[model samples]
Target: MSGSTFALRVAQGVGFTGAAWLSGNIAALSANSVPAIISSVREDNISPNVACKQWRNMYEAGKTQNPPIAFATASSFAYVAWSVRQIPRSLAASAAYGGFGMYVAAAVLTLSIVPYTVAAMRPTNNALLELAESKGDRVTSSAEVEGLLGRWTTLNWARSLLPLAGGFAGIAAALL
Candidate 1:
């Protein structure tokens, strides 16, 4: 209900959506490789026409033969690429909706952190004020403020990490 609390909620919502979009972009780039991989996978004699007709002709002539070799000649990378390609279009489609969901979730998450941040800041601010009022005199109370700030910093960092990790996981899951 406080101004800071409201601001935190808004920030969280924005951060979450930003994270999701970032993830989606990564997934999109990865997914784009799928079509190429599919083409490459089919490049073998098994499906000469899976890719370009020019390559098919070369295959028929025995001039060159190998899977179109997407990602790399390495099967594992190829498989990873293929896996990336396999991410359902529906998921991507749903990502559009998921974006909104992320925003809401982020907002809620951020809002939840407000009270904790406020609590942390209160002691820190008090110490800071006390130190300032002392006018150059050393103040032991500054340590409490510093500690609270450190805790807040750690939590903020954690908040950032969650969306990043979640986004990557979502992308990986989609790829699989």
Candidate 2:
């Protein structure tokens, strides 16, 4: 019922929604034929087979991206909540140990936010590379420069803020 618990629930809900959306997209792509994929890719102005390949590649890249870090931070926040819940019913000896445990848990939880933020901020080079290749452009400043710059700039902006927001959340969790 506390604010941190509410925030953690929100984070979990968002994560689940994202995971579901990604899974659904993957399934839809998988069920489509090669030609369908190719046509879709071409319609999007990307290379042949890039749709299927990029889908799988991006998914793999995300495995090492922001989601895992967010999940870890959320999990740690949940643990902190549980630890706080334990404090009131504890005996003197139990209170001391439990309080120490809670502090440790909070610190660990806070520490986890850093990695999550870092992961979120870090650009997915694989995605960028695939996009670059699909465009058949050597330098990003070519005729297809807009596409290249757009993608990179969008990702860069996301990376810049993710860590800061994550760190703020971690500090908030610790304070809670």
Candidate 3:
């Protein structure tokens, strides 16, 4: 009814939608794409260079697409927190506080994947990128590509969890 109420609803909707989309997108890469790339090497007898190139393409796509989703989701969650904080505490003090806290948590969790990618995933990413670009010059063996893909898959799954949790947090905020 009120403008702030409408804003909170909109923010919550955006936050939840974005989080779900982002998390699922990243997880799909980990679960499906990366594994298929790995299989292309191990089972399909594809060249390591080819597999590396495929991975690089996937990486580039995710790099271009995922960050914007993360930024939007985190921003929406933060906006939700801010909007909830503006509500008069006298009207519903406990719910307002709880919602604010949950929304803040959601924002933090959604944003954390950036640092996680930087700290945990970057080394493997760089190595794989170099191997992809090197076109067999840098690669020591197929095992190297396999190892890198496995590591990336694990790290990406971990990365997906943050947004998943953030989405759940946003849902909890809505219930509050």
Candidate 4:
């Protein structure tokens, strides 16, 4: 096989794996980790301050980890699309063009979570971070912390869908 063929295969593999990994990581946080933190506060097992601080720690960790995954996944998808584009149309069938489209879409969708977070989720994140920094003193009651946490969870759930969609697109491309 040619170098371009090898690169295309590598890009496809990286894009699919990275997209799935990022999506699963986000979903795990949304489904299990965040809820457990909120549950601790709700059950009074931990003070709201402690819960917020714990949440902040998790959020910070994700901030460090997730962006790189997203970017790498998107870059891989973009590279796959570029590689697909390099194939001569006479040799590349209609399915190859379709895969190229899907790869491009995958790249866009995978990267979209970053802007989505900035636009849709930043306010809640900022508020939560503030509360965490204040040791929960900024809020009137534990309920407020719970509300923010719930909102964050909901937003995160939505955010998780972007990479999931990208992964699905990647799968669709591979099938094509």
Candidate closest to the true structure, highest TM-score:
3
TM of each candidate vs. truth: 0.28, 0.34, 0.94, 0.93
Q: Write the per-residue lDDT of candidate 1 for residues 66-89, one digit (tens) a residue.
A: 112111112222232333343456
Global lDDT scores for all candidate models: 0.37, 0.44, 0.91, 0.88
How well does model 4 score by local distance difference test? 0.88
| TM-score of candidate 1 against the unseen true structure | 0.28
Q: What is the per-residue lDDT of model 3 for residues 1-176, given as tens digits with 9 covering 90 to 100?
A: 98877877888899999999999999999999999998889899998888988999999999999888899999999998998888777867999899999999999999898899999999999988888888445645789889989999999999999999999999998897
> Predictions ranked by TM-score, top down?
3, 4, 2, 1
Ranking by lDDT: 3, 4, 2, 1
lDDT at residue 132 of model 1 (Cα atoms): 36
Q: How do the residues 86-119 of candidate 2 rate in per-residue lDDT, one tens digit apiece?
A: 5555456555454445534433433343464346
| Candidate 2 vs candidate 4, lDDT winner | 4
- The RMSD of every model to the true structure, in order and in angstroms, is 27.1, 11.3, 1.3, 1.6
Better of 2 and 4 by TM-score: 4
Task: Give me the runs in candidate 2 sitting further than 4 Å from their true place.
Answer: 1-65, 89-141
Better of 3 and 4 by TM-score: 3
Query: How much lDDT does candidate 2 score?
Result: 0.44
| Tens digit per residue, CA lDDT, model 4, 1-176 | 98878888898899999998898999899899988998887786687778888999999999899998999999999999888777777655888899899999999999898999999999999988887788334553678888999999999999999998998998898898
**For model 4, what is the alpha-carbon lDDT of residue 53?**
86
